[model samples]
Target: MTTKATTDDTAVRTSVRVDAAPEHAFEVFTAGMDRWWTRAHHVQKGELKEIGVEPRAGGRLWEENDAGDVCTWGRVLTWDPPRTFAFSWLIGPNWQIPAEDAAGSRVTVTFTPTDTGTLVELVHDGFEVHGPGWEGVRGGVGSDGGWPAGLRQFAAAL
Candidate 1:
């Protein structure tokens, strides 16, 4: 079963269960990021070679391509091992970064132990600050190719 709740108007939330220990799940989600995160969702100029979450507070979540160009998606906000991970995701309007101003949203992922394995909860919020074009960004995230596909890939990797 999947449950989605929207809080504060534009925020989106989703949860999925994975058949793995919380430690393993978190490791795969963060460390093994490149193995699951879809390439189509990124905003980069060159072909992507690697994508990863830099596992610490204030660290960068980045995607690097074959041309040695790096595009940073956000900064890690919270990094609690095997439990919670949060970051600011800034892809800007229509997946394009602003030349002068960058507006970002927040995504938080939590891992909970369960009888079967682990429960992964994701929350993407803070859209109001993205300004007028926020609706487009919000819609994309709730679309088929967004969290649903991303979580499916993540679960499959486990």
Candidate 2:
């Protein structure tokens, strides 16, 4: 994943490129974000009940816990099949960062075909004034870290 510092702001942008078909890649990435997303790495680990995406603009990206409680992880901001999808990243209070300032961010995943394979890019944009922590989260949870493993699980499912 590519993590960059903004020129005139405290926000950060992160991206990743993957090798897979566009449709396949997109489907896998979305469907599998929960599977390979480390339980130990999540804020609602033992309590995590269910995780899923609705696959449409205005659809819900959510999770539930054993207590029959649920939370909105995000909403689908844009949904273009086989091409791209953008969602609100409401991982605020769920993260190690301070809740008061963790207003959350955006996650945009784009799929493009190349001569060799598909290029999957995941961008996490927006951050508070705290620089290193944001970068650390982006780097830790993206690319071959969390999402990639999820993609691999998705591929296996297919």
Candidate 3:
């Protein structure tokens, strides 16, 4: 969750075209998140029941497990429907919320209508906060098994 120096390599951005309208794309990304997001991405130790982003500004992005335990990953920063969405990603290296703002990051997703469907773009920034520990987190999120993989799953679900 560390913020990195504002550089191209520091910000993890990915875009995918989905076979749905902008509104439907937004719904699947937010309201229907649990159906697409993978349990393997959870930092929890039990079976995951759901992972959701509350559909409003300031709402929490959280995960609930079969054991009834909940963990919050971030908070919604903006809630523009069928277009743009942004949130604070506060989880840190130890899989816990950062104690200070400098240790957290931001994630913004945009949905734009195209000839075929909607183009969903995700940008994960602010990794400089981790100071020396930034690279590992960036690699994890940008790797084949990270956000790209998750988005692929999301598109397939749609």
Candidate 4:
């Protein structure tokens, strides 16, 4: 996995590999984000109803709950088929404030085809503004209780 903080210094990036084709891996990752993502660890808890990715640049990355409330988690910044996808990552009060009229941090996921399978590189930038508090959020999402387990689930679904 590859990880780095933004130039401003408040976010983190993490990448990992999956045993699947690039296109398939990308589909599994985005279409099945909710399935593998740990429900218990979600910021909204049991209230999280659905996680949706619109599959295009400027598409919405959002969640809804049983209460009929919809919250935008992010927006697609770049969408290159079978190779790369970039979006905003905003959750919780801390990450909600826009850095420059833009909501949350930027997360880019790149898929590279390898002889064995696809290598998924996730880049989550923008966090230095939040300072120490961002660490907890980053750490939480990195642990087994977060994205790792979620990505594993995504891979298993394929």
Task: Report the C-alpha lDDT of model 3 over 39-117, residue by residue, as the tens digit.
Answer: 7778677788889998899898888888988878788999999999999877666665345453567889999898889
Q: Which ten residues in a row have the lowest lDDT in candidate 1?
A: 1-10
Give the whole-model CA lDDT for all candidates, comma-separated: 0.82, 0.60, 0.79, 0.66
lDDT of 2: 0.60
Quote the lDDT for 2 in model 1.
42
lDDT of 1 by residue, 1-158 (tens): 34344434667777788889999999999999899998866677767789998889989888888888887888899999899999887876678643334667899999999998999998998876777888777778867678767888888888
Error of 3 at 86 (Å): 0.9
TM-score of each: 0.90, 0.66, 0.88, 0.77
lDDT of 2 by residue, 8-31 (tens): 243233334445667877777677
Clashes of 4: 4
Q: lDDT by residue for model 4 over 1-158, one digit each (tens)?
A: 22222222344445566667898888877877777665554444346677789988989887776777766667899999788988877653353423334445567788899887887777666643345577665665555545555555666676
Over 4 Å off, model 4: 1-13, 92-102, 129-132
Query: What TM-score number comes out for model 2?
Result: 0.66
lDDT of 3: 0.79
Ranking by TM-score: 1, 3, 4, 2
Q: How far is 119's C-alpha from truth in model 3 (Å)?
A: 0.8
RMSD of 4: 4.2
Residue 151 in model 1: shift from native, Å?
A: 0.5
